[model samples]
Target: MGTLEDLTDALARDVIAAMDEIGDDRFFEKVSKLLLDMSPTTQEAYMTAIRVRLAERRARKYVEDALHAARAAKAKAPE
Candidate 1:
């Protein structure tokens, strides 16, 4: 099985590819907004964990954004 780092790299690549395919500035803007909305304490905790170098915070951000989008899409879909 792949390690967490390997999985993170794969996810990051997927996110980048998805962004490239969509070619929409709003997609990124939405992600930025989400990041901004995160609590300062949460952000600080993430930064501290990432500073250890064992974790990839960027990958976490990508996954968080993707999950947010997925939830939004599901909410919008017909029940």
Candidate 2:
């Protein structure tokens, strides 16, 4: 079985991706329902965790894009 951390990461990533695709009103409804049912502490913890995961995802994408651009430039350079 996957660890708790692994499960959390996967679920959060999936939620973030879905939010990206959904309209604002639908996203607000779904997320508000999910979080509003939680206790205050639980809500804070989940928000913190998702924010961390999103930051990591953005950083990874930035690095990957930079590397790809550098590699393409290198390939096009004269030997």
TM-score of 1: 0.33
Q: Residue 18: error of model 2 in Å? A: 2.2
Model 1: CA > 4 A from native: 1-55
Q: Write the per-residue lDDT of candidate 2 for residues 56-75, one digit (tens) a residue.
A: 97899999999999999999
Q: What lDDT, from 0 to 1, does candidate 1 have?
A: 0.53
Candidate 2 residue 67 Cα shift, in angstroms, is 0.4
Candidate 2 regions with alpha-carbon error over 4 angstroms: 1-11, 21-37
* Top candidate by lDDT: 2
lDDT per residue as tens, model 1, 1-79: 3454454444444445566799853353354345448655433443333343324646788899999999999999999
* Residue 63, candidate 1: alpha-carbon lDDT: 92
